[model samples]
Target: MKMEFDLRMTQEQKLIMTQQMQMSVKILQMTNMEMQSYITKEIEENPILETEKKSKEKKDDIDYKELIKYLDDDFNYSNKNYYVNNEEEVSPFTFISAKKSLKEYLIEQVIDLNLSESLKYLCMYIVEDIDSRGYLYTNKNILAEELNVEISTVEEALKVIHSLDPPGIGGVNLIECLKIQLNKKQITDKEIYLIVENYLQSMADNKYAVIAKELNISIQEAQRYGDIIKTLEPKPSRGFYTGEETNYISPEAHIKKINDEYFVIMNNDEIPKLNINKTYKNIIYNDEDEKTVKYVKDKINSALFLIKSINQRESTIFRILTKLVEVQRDYFDMGEKYLKPLTLKELAEMLQIHESTVSRAIRDKYVYTDKGTIKIKDLFITGIAQNNYDDNVSTLIIKKEIKNIVESEDSKKPYSDQKICDLLKEKNFNISRRTVAKYREELEIKSSSKRKRY
Candidate 1:
């Protein structure tokens, strides 16, 4: 073996991600609210960057106005009579009411109980420990020791807590919560009770036959009662204010149909327009001190690049959405059934950009349409082939068809995946039984055995 140690020179090219380029990609991926926060933080730290206030451009005056109108009727807040008249029927939209917290509601109910004062106080203390999920998560032994009371006394107070309204509140576990709710409803069905008490996990796994055998009932009968169990609320504190705020999705763009053409309209209300601070303008490298000149130069470059990155992000989104509108015209014009199959790679090729660029453009972003607000990524569905045809059908359309078929199916003899696939064949969706099963799983639809009812 000869060891060759000759010095050689070769030319090579590699893609390097610069700081500004990385920032641009991040800006591309950010949702509108996130972008707003980022810009605000940048404004605070970077002196050279200031938000540009446009005078006559007249952009971003509205945000979700149409959405609110579409969702609910225009509520009149100027009605003075709502406060004045107690006899008039109070409409839901008449006013915003200060709702009682769960703690307050439970405490108020406890106060009204004809119990001893000490007992009532103990119950209140236990109520204070009930978690947002309406379950008593604290250990009873520890609580009893802390309160200097016997475990039996704490158990007695918990019994009182269990009797409170919102039937499932104060349960130590899921089983207890469900039992409490069932007791309140006067559900004396022994089988259903047994299902809740013992077979809850089995029921979740859709093992109806196992439950039927254990309860000495027919498999069909088990599922019939299982339907009733499905109606029970798991989260008792749901819809009640649990001190946690729920953030709603706000779309970044709207697609509108004017005449026969569809157009993409940007939601600009929250996105801040940027400009270099006019006070610091032309101050870059024009200062008396060399240090000041260097400082100004660096800051100015950063500010300019930040502005450019944001602009580029917006432009890219606009181009992508514009193309999306053209591509998904059928979905917008007709219904979800007409949705075309498109993928990030296919769309990236169509727009002559990298697949990752398209992914980042739509990541965590939503767009409003005549149908409703939907995730931008929802538009990019993989195609399913039709029987002996060049055109491919969207998996979305196929999924919808599958859901409809399942919904209309005879519960006693539910369609198997093979049967479902055969049914779809009549509609020209040339998918296999395995593909049907995959789609069924994705839709969260139960299998033939699980779906069967008495």
Candidate 2:
């Protein structure tokens, strides 16, 4: 037997991702605000692109009849108008005064107290060290080393911070924060203070009987003190801004019902229309130098690709939403209860596109429906098997059912996880007791014992 090396030639077909293709994918995944920022940056960098301006004369000559006809043809909906202004008017005072941060508020209170220059400086340092949750976790020794002072001095500064206007602003932990608030309020109940300091875990677990026995009190008394402790603020800086502004979500599409038929509408109007600059186009056509011509050609190609990518993104999103509405028509007619289980793979197969393409199309995108603004991805949910129903139900539907059951339960004797599981089974959801507990925890619902009231 002999071994010989054999060589053979074979042709293979492979797809390589081009730079423009990558750009298109990136643009497809960007949210509305992100796409706006990206386009603005591109326009500033490239001299061959400009945003198209709408003329007042053209706007004035708009025909309502033709517009309605076009919409009817595209969406197969009636010409009934449903647009209404739902935005509430904001108070002028809201814009007049900027929000005061937790740090600034603390600093202002510190200024009102008379202190030595060194102490005031130390107080400022402590104030700055407090986290967004209004808790100071920095070690006194480390702070003293940084400020070139004794550990006792840092401790003194912390004490001063603990006395600030927000009762629990400078506490080191949840227990300490509660103690600080209790002390500030002059709460003289020794049992309440001791429970907060020692048996907070037992209290959270609803071991009220054990706590009462340990403290030589009745379970009712323990529950009454626990209720008082619940009134304390866990997050002292909740109302204060942390140098971050609220982000407003803009829906990328809309689903409207007209005469019992649902229609999908893409929000192309929010995006600015872009076109190649006439001057740059003329320069590219008239150029003779190879280097200058190449530069202009590259920029022009980039601008063209960006514009095409924007249009393609919108078209792809519209197609995906159209397919979604077709499949989930029951969801649109009824509510989330009727939402069917869907997956990117299934939708991609229906559209004859890659699963990743479907993912990119729905990334950070939202849709406005009769149910209000909802993330596009939220529409796709995994299905769970049901004993009674022919088809599987969505996990979201199960969660909604669990939430409803908990909401309607008696507060004095809340349903246990096992009881909840039995109730869901009666409703056709054959789920286990453990799964019910897991879903309950995910919904932030406490255990039956913890939810019990005296």
Candidate 3:
């Protein structure tokens, strides 16, 4: 055990708060509208920063108008009478509200259950496993394995869950669902309960006579019980809209068709309009306190950083969108038929951006156009091949074509995916049978096996 003081001098390259990293994370997360608002704030706060150029070319001015339109369209804030009379009717539109997470709902309801913290969390985990149709499709053994808890503990929590509101909401299967319903109704008739338990499928398929015969009950009594089953809400959360949904979709950009020439507008509104605190400035002008001066300086720096972040975000997004629009301009004017094959790598190379950056920019980022709200990211894809044209066409166009063929085909004898692909090839659109099936599946179309006539 030797105790020695060692001195070492090393000079290694280090990344000290690079702009590129900030641009990738902070700037890309914000939309064009957010960037614009930030830029305005920067100008107000920081005396050092200024816009590069103020061109009055009227290029893209959708930010102000589109924000006002989207907000006004979904929400009614201007109507004083409506606000006064129907205040309660306004839905909650926040991040919490939109999540619709069943775990949160269960936790809220059972706050007074007096369970231990671990058990409480376990209950929440179990609740999340319940499907939208209110069935706990995952087995307790499986859930226990997943949560690294004992199966017995899951079983115990499940019993507590069974006692919750919206009976049948936490059932493992239809048998449990009916058992919950029967428990809630306090039915004395075992025959009626048995009919619900065993012959649920037959009951669903209107095999009431079979169910009545098996239960040794009259068809009328069985029919009455079936009617009662119909009244039970399968999804207990269906009508219960959360009061936390942020009922506003601020677009990444806007494509306005002004006299047929489309203009790309970046959304920028609701962001805080910042300015230098004149009162604080006046205080500084006079014999200001050192602490106050330092605080203002820090805030001013922060404001400038925020502004630069927003401006950079807007510039990158605008550049990417410009390239996208230039490439997919034909799709904008000529409709779905003219959509070309495109990919993120191709766009990234063109704009000198990382592929992931392109992905983030388009993630949940919508663009308003004459065709309504279109996802900005949907423009890029692998093209569908065509005859006399070596390059591929858009898969979207092929799917649209497939959809058309399926829609036109006789419902009694639906066209197989192979037939649709053959038809498209004859129409000079060269596509594979597998590709047709792929596109058809993407469109959520059932295969010939599933689409068979009764």
Q: Report the error of model 3 at residue 126, Å.
A: 24
lDDT of each residue in 1-454, candidate 1, tens digit only: 9998999999999999988788989988988878888999998998866665732323243222332232222322221111111222222112224455788889999999999999999999998898888888887999989999999999899889988888789888888888888888888889998999889888877788999998999987888778788887777877566676434465767776779887676765667777655545345425577677667666766776676677667778888988888898888888888888889998899989999999999998887777767889988889988987999989998999999999999878999999999999999999999999999999999889777665
Q: Write the per-residue lDDT of candidate 3 for residues 1-454, one digit (tens) a residue.
A: 9999999999999878775456447657665445556567657656534343432323243232233231212322221111111122221111113345555666687777989988888888887777766678788989889988888999988887877876777888777776787777787677767766677777666666777788788877877787777776655544343343333456555665568676566554334433333333444446457776666555545544454455555666777777888898898998867877889989999888899888877776777666767778788878766899888868787778888898888865888877897899888898889988888888888886545432
Evaluate all candidate structures by whole-model CA lDDT and list the values in order.
Answer: 0.78, 0.80, 0.66
Off by over 4 Å in 3: 1-24, 31-241, 244-248, 276-298, 410-423, 426-428
How well does candidate 3 match the true structure in TM-score terms?
A: 0.51
Top-TM-score structure, candidate number: 1
The alpha-carbon lDDT assigned to residue 316 of candidate 2 equals 77
Clashing pairs in 2: none
Evaluated at residue 181, the lDDT of candidate 2 is 93
Off by more than 4 A, model 1: 1-6, 50-134, 144-167, 216-221, 239-247, 273-275, 278-293
**Which pairs, if any, clash in model 1?**
none
The local distance difference test score of model 3 is 0.66
TM-score for all models, in order of appearance: 0.76, 0.68, 0.51
Q: What TM value does model 2 have?
A: 0.68
Candidate 2 local accuracy as lDDT?
Answer: 0.80
Candidate 1 TM-score, true structure as reference: 0.76
